[model samples]
Target: MEVGGSPTWSEPNGPPSPDLTSHAELPEKLRPKNIFEIPVWMGEPDRFCGLVVEWNNEPVHVLPFQKGYMIFGRDPAVSNTFVGHPSVSRQHAAIVWSREDRLAYLIDLESENGTYIDDIQIPLNEPVKLLPGHRISFASCFRRYVFIDQYDRVVKELRKSRPTVRVRHILVKHAESGRPSSWRGETITRTRDEARAQIQSYRRQILEKQEDFGRIASEVSDCTSAKRGGDLGPIFPGQNKAAFEEIAFRLNVGEVSEPVETLSGFHIILREG
Candidate 1:
């Protein structure tokens, strides 16, 4: 249910009248039918990456596996993914990430239609480990999910092969006339360690908050591709430099690289494709 960003909850759907202070005090007629709550993404590293909801062959909804309970249901105000179907409850089910065990469990939120794993109904409120290709369903609502983690093994299962990824980069030169990574009209006139520190900060923000890589690349990237959000297009193995290929083949689709050193400069990579 949680998505990482600027630590702000998304209220995509709000109450009919913004003046209503008390949800309980609001009159029935003025009540908003769909109030969705964007789950607060946890900053914990090494947690499960996310779940791809592919129910009924519908468009996928990515539910990031962040540090807290991921709540799902029809109530947009409370649930991260609000199922528009009639069968879905406002607060139907939740997926909890156990830090100690490094496992994710699907617990029924006392949903009316019940929650299912692989077509079998699970006991209420009990935790169940969702395996790869395991379908997490809410009753007969037709919503389904396939889970994937940050590790390359899990990513291979998700894509059915090692992918040829597209990547974008913001390169900051460290030598003479070194320039800033972004479009701030600044130059990298600092020491190598200082440049790395600055670039690494950008990488940290993207990973911790799930910031949009393309947007950051657009604003700060030093390369000409910054105009296109540093898009390098589809890159196969060995097509890029040794270090770049090392990261490209190993990184997950949405992963960001720490500031990397090359002959030319330090670069921050985003696996766009």
Candidate 2:
């Protein structure tokens, strides 16, 4: 970034932080002015463009600026916003555009499996500076990435498919309890708000022990489908409610849905296909 011909970066609200550039010499007239403030438009699409993190032999993720923060993770229920990928932590990492300074920061949310920027594991809760093009990795060593600031280039190169997936779920009923119950023994009556909170909690538990969904569902799910290990079969249109269909269709293969509520009750859905 440049301000008044001077190299620029986000500062900690003090003196202009040291120049991040160590490249070729610049003309005196093009030299940076001290303590320059960045405008709100700095992160706008017309200004800094956006990023595409290429991994798995292709551009797997494209995040546009001015779209608020871009959250990347594996748990669909935990990080209910933005892109979701397999094997990545539910609350993995985020690219935040600082409201205070019009600059971007990548902050890790302290996931079970860590997030990496250029092979260095990001520490929990710390904000790392994001340059124009940097790499980020989630959950594995082979999954390398190249984050580019060019927007149109990535969109043109994007070759992703939106294939549907098969699914199953563990329905932990709250209608009879008047509040959500996870382990099937709570008799205490609670409100809808409490039910929602309990459902979110259950979603977290389900995500962490994903492989045990069927076994756990058979032991815990209130629905009769639990007898068949919670299998819902191929989701056909009109078989389920519109809300459930909307979220079910968006799930990546092998990803699980967060606690979802409907006339039936709170649900923990898994995309088997």
Query: What tens-digit string does per-residue lDDT give for candidate 1 at 183-208?
Result: 55654567778668878887888878
Q: Which candidate is the best by lDDT?
A: 1
What are the lDDT figures for the candidates, one per model? 0.61, 0.55
Cα miss at 201, model 1 (Å)? 52
Q: Write the per-residue lDDT of candidate 2 for residues 30-144, one digit (tens) a residue.
A: 6432321232222433335456646566665554554445555443323323233445564567666543223456667766678888778877655565665677777663555
Instruction: Give all TM-scores, in the order shown.
Output: 0.41, 0.35
Q: State how far residue 184 of model 1 sits from its true place (Å).
A: 66
Model 1 error, position 91 (Å): 0.8
Worst 10 residues of 1 by lDDT: 3-12
